[model samples]
Target: MTTNILINRRSIQILRILVSGIFLVAGLNHLLNVEKTAQRIEQANFKGIAYFFGEPQWLIILSGIVMLSAGFLFLIGYKTKWAAIILMAVLIPITLTVQVGQITSLGPLFKNIAILGGLLFFILNDTEKKLI
Candidate 1:
């Protein structure tokens, strides 16, 4: 006997919400803790990337804004592909600058990888009718 669980639209939307929630919360934290988060970025293995972008605090704030807005869009199933692309753009540098090359960050690194996989789902298969 084989059990095949059919995934439905509601299931996918729930997964989308679950995936976007992390980015939404993280974005809020970035904006709320700009100084502290910037300091952490300054101490990361690739602080130069942050500096190259601009002031670490400003970068944090900018990324926070992007993540928060795009994450909300992603959660609400509107322009999901674009939102996922935007999020993946923000996530890559963060994962590289903060999580990579750190022994203690393996768990978070893999978590981001999993999140990437989830976002990739939207980017690859989001075929809902567009509103704009």
Candidate 2:
């Protein structure tokens, strides 16, 4: 029983770290490469939404802030549900703008879908019990 519990704890910890890592890295990229990221956003199929938010650079900075903050919270298993919710909120528009409607981007689209599933897991379940 103890061994099983240990395994489950480790599994959840690993999963949490992996899930949060993607956002952390992406957040850093947006923060560090605002112009390039903005250019990518501008070139996306649904870039109008990016413009709707404001200048693409500003949007990218906002996104980076949200992702870094929420990603850290999620990684540390603090306020995880809210963190997941925030991440999902940011991800939908990004997925739609950059990944959707492009045949070549199917892989990234599916990857984002899977990431959504991971975030949904945190939102729907109290993983805190198993996390510690």
Give the alpha carbon lDDT tens digit for every residue of 1-132 in model 2.
Answer: 233233367777788899999999999999999999988887788888778778888889999999999999989989888999999999998888888877876999999999999999888777776444
lDDT of 2 at 23: 97
lDDT tens digits, residue span 1-132, model 1: 665445577778888999999999999999999989988897888887778778888889999999999999999988999999999999998988888877876999999999999999889774474322
In model 1, the Cα lDDT at residue 21 comes to 96
Model 1 CA lDDT for position 102: 77
Query: Cα lDDT of model 2 overall?
Result: 0.88
Query: Could you tell me the lDDT of residue 122 within candidate 2?
Result: 80
TM-scores of all predicted structures: 0.89, 0.89
